[model samples]
Target: MITETRVKIDWDSLGFDVVKTKSMFKATCPIDGKWSEGSLVPYGTIQLSPAAGVLNYGQGVFEGTKAFRTVKGDVILFRPDRNAQRMAFSTKRLCIPEMDTEFFLDAVLKTVQDNIDYVPPYGKGSLYIRPIVWGTAPALGVRPVSEYTFMIFVSPVGPYFKGGVKPLNLKVSTQFHRAAAKGIGNAKAIGNYSASLFPLMKAKSEGFDEVIYLDAIDGKRVEELGSANLFIYKEGVIRTPALSGSILEGVTRNSVCRIASDILNIPVEETDVDITDVLKAEEVFCTGTAVVVTPVGKITYQGETTTINGNQMGSVTEKIRQTILAIQRGEMNDPFGWIFPVNQIFKR
Candidate 1:
């Protein structure tokens, strides 16, 4: 079994990589149509059939979110309910049984509590929660499985970028599309990422931090970064691509829109953003659960490059990042009732 004693490590040097914690939560369901009450188990691998549905057909979905250790020595989760809702949406599309919000939140909270000792210090990092559901039954045809597994694991991770909080150089991919216009792009399916691997690798090899995919149909409208949602600011307005059924609606992206409009009093718009608008924007950034908000220094498209905010982080971007981080870490008030204290769920 995984231990409660914290392992020794350089927390300051942590990256957005997996470092297994004490325990994980798991449950199973069979064709009989009943889900077992999940339990906390030691962190380890599980045996699967050679023809497991997930292995063969990629019938799986997952979520990424973080739990922070507050300055007051409390652990808190940020908008887990939204993650639960998104997971349900994904599973429904994949034809897998969806877990209710109560069960999903309970599993996440229990896993965090079981691995409490591994929760990084407030400033060092936060505990990253990954909840995945997969079809487990052996299958030979392209169909849903009769058996399924749901599990959640926790890890402590630092910033996604190696250098931390710096503007990233992005490359636009016209030769490839991350998702079709009427496909499962909006779902958190494992297959969606698998399709992006080659383009992302090519972008990295070309010295770009990430790749921004254009729409599959016209290949002119902006979609999103490989792992995050895109946003551009110009003339006191913040605009991001609308939910065109091809972009993953990011939790951080939603939070930024709300914070910008409600707190910062800045106008926010969701519409079809042309690539030219991105090239001329005063500032550009991407948001995700992992990379909360990262500025874009430069974007290259069709052998032409454009610099945003003189290749520096914009003031509005900085303010939005700070405000969200502050609310997450409990340094500022969360008027939206987004923060859920772990202590309230599980006694210390």
Candidate 2:
């Protein structure tokens, strides 16, 4: 195992682009539950064969979330338990070792808390937590590797997009589909993201910031972005793509729905979102822990373009984003109990 060596950090120039933290937590898959002790070490590479299962068979899953500093000098983690459960779903689909829910949460909390200093100030930015589980053994054939590893780390991140809260233009990819219907579309697995790199780049080169992937089967319905789940707002109501077994069950997406209904008194509709409807939507936006709330201004389809209402974050969006931010900052009342404060730690 490698060790995390502390280095000088340029906090003044930090953005949400690269990994800054040097330390991470790692634990190997326990054969028959005979797990080895975990460790907090330098964030570095793991030894693997050229014919590793992950290299050939693409066996892996991942998760993304953030920890933020509250207004009152406290660190809070936005809904973390949901991340654990989602990992379970990803593991089940990728044939990886079942991560014990309790253990998973415990490890992640400890990992983030250990690097609390890496967490930025209340308003500057946040600590991004990325947990990855992957097969380690080298396998030339198409089979699950017997050995696996799980690790978590933290890095302070700024606005996910280069510009802050700027409206984005997206393109509908009718050629390359995001995910297969029954395949790993819903799972936050490695290959799923790997498959997106090409099409996303093509869309980027085509003068769009993001590519909106459609269902592979028919290519008529909307799926999601390369990184986050999508939501559409219009006519005093919010709408998003339903979990069609191809859409990842996004934690932030769910929270937005709850806030819209319980707090804002707006109805949130989760169902099949027709690409054409979103094109004609009064407002279009996407949500995730990283992106937060980003409004879509225009979508370029072939040669035609459809503009969302006002081409800016709507009033409802502003309200919900502020509400959620307040909850994270421990400012307003947490009526829904979405934020989880760290109270325990795992000492080495």
Clashing pairs in 1: none
Candidate whose lDDT is highest: 1
In terms of lDDT, model 2 sits at 0.82
In candidate 2, which residue pairs clash? 3-42, 4-42, 282-309
**In candidate 2, residue 119 scores what lDDT?**
76
TM-scores, each model vs. reference: 0.96, 0.93
lDDT of each: 0.91, 0.82
lDDT of 2 by residue, 1-348 (tens): 111225445555567876757689899883345334678888776677887677788888889988888998688888888998999889878888787777788888888878887777777788899988878777777888888888897888888888788888998888888788888888898988899999998888888889899888788899898888888877878999989988888998999999999989999999888898888787788888888888888898767888777677777778888988888888898998677787632221
What tens digits encode model 1's per-residue C-alpha lDDT throughout 135-219?
9999999989899999999889999988999899999998899998889999999999999999999999999999999999998
